[model samples]
Target: MSSAYKTSAVENTSKYGPFTKMVDVYGLKILGLGNVGGQPQVSTEFLNKTAETFKLLLDPNAAGINKKSREKALKGLTSYNVIQRVGVKAHITHTRQALIAAKYRAGTKSMTSIDQEQTSSGICDLMGGPTLLLEQAQITENLEHALHTITQFALPAAFPQEMNISSKNGKASGISGDLYKALREAIANGVYDDSDYSRQR
Candidate 1:
């Protein structure tokens, strides 16, 4: 996993696309760990493998490559894989925690801190957390690509609302009070995904 991410950084320097590099690094990391994660004794090995992979992805030197005419080719590759992996792990850990929570809900435990902590982690709550690993491995990286990747595939609910805001922004002041009002309404009504944009709101 570590070598895969390191090589991905080197390879992605010439491509200079965040979405593509994210998909590549993520796929490579997951694929490398897939077989190892299946074995009971090697479960911790898989986790360690992913951790080392993140370390290489976060390394400054390997990501500082310059293609004389291009932007920072390795820019988005940093932290993206690590954070995504963190999200995936949190999903797994919280799933187990949810079982613990359920037992508490069933009166198995006097307190529910384990389950409450599981509830606070966002990943496990998304679509019940079952599909989170696949989504993280597959669709999540496309967010940085063309909007169609998000609109048509990764996020459908966000696009129509985004179009609504965009249409209102064509006026004299651009993004008028009506747009703000609509945005606030959308946010208050919980129409957006829990993305960075949503957090900023």
Candidate 2:
């Protein structure tokens, strides 16, 4: 049996928080080993069984999942395919935004024209000024663009509930908050798909 399957079986047996932590540690070790070119030998049956166990753990309703069910409701979040998808989405979004910013900077003669073009192209709406800084960094060799890019990627993935906080309190926060909110909404609304990233190529 796969280590993942064994771990999942153990996880189902205990309600203790430390057990969960141990499972997480083991899972990470397994993932690390896989990354280091020593992938564990696991059967397809084992993997499928482990996935089913995970699905059961994630579902609030312990009732069996029907094969014909179109949508399965999950109680707890699972890392499953979400992390990979998010990573791809972020990469594609950043690269596309940077290319657009570079193209805009190259073609525009003035700051006003740059702003007009950015607004028209919706780059500003997607990434704010960080992408523009990335393009400027290419010409000026500035390290701040690297820092801005890091900050841009670190923004929260969920929408902010306090929309009026900025206007009501007169406190300025990071510029990426609105961008994160928009991105979250877009994801929830299915505005972008997995195949959307392929179009960038």
lDDT of 2 by residue, 1-201 (tens): 234323333122122211111122112111100111122222233233333433443332457734222122110012121110000112333433443443321111111011000101222222333554433432222123222321222111112332211233332333335554665578679985435554532
Shift of residue 21 alpha carbon in model 1, Å: 29
Q: Using TM-score, give the best candidate's number.
A: 1
Off by over 4 Å in 2: 1-36, 59-201
- lDDT values for all models: 0.30, 0.25
For candidate 1, write residues 1-201 as lDDT tens digits: 344334332221212111111223322222111111121111333334443443454344465633321112123222222222112233444344433343321111111111010112223334455545433533332222222221222122223333332334455335434445676678679995436564433
Model 2 collision count: 0
